[model samples]
Target: MALQSLQITALTAMRARDVSRPSREQQEAADRRPLRDETPRRDQPHRGRDR
Candidate 1:
């Protein structure tokens, strides 16, 4: 049998994480931010053959 003190239910775990986090809106904004450092430059068009 599991010990009472060691037991952790899913709802309590979820609530702990939710409470420790910053305001919900700011947390959401940070999560949405991009991970990539820089985007690759698009290839430049080449000059057409001289007439």
Candidate 2:
């Protein structure tokens, strides 16, 4: 049926997305730079509330 086909298509798309996600190491490396940048701000006395 059309609905069944649509469901299968959605499942395939979801699987594809899962497969395309970055590996754990790649994700951690990406996160490291931003965290490093924030560290200095966190250490500062005037990390304003507007952030």
The candidate maximizing TM-score is: 2
What is the C-alpha lDDT profile of model 2 across 1-51, one tens digit per residue? 776665557889999999999999999988776656565554545658657
State each model's C-alpha RMSD to the native.
11.5, 6.7
- Candidate 1 residue-wise lDDT, 1-51, digit = tens: 467569778999999998887998997997788656655666876678453
TM-score of 1: 0.35
Model 1: lDDT to the true structure: 0.80
Weakest lDDT window of 10 consecutive positions for candidate 1: 34-43
**What TM-score would each prediction reach against the true structure?**
0.35, 0.42
Per-candidate count of clashing residue pairs (backbone under 3 Å): 0, 0
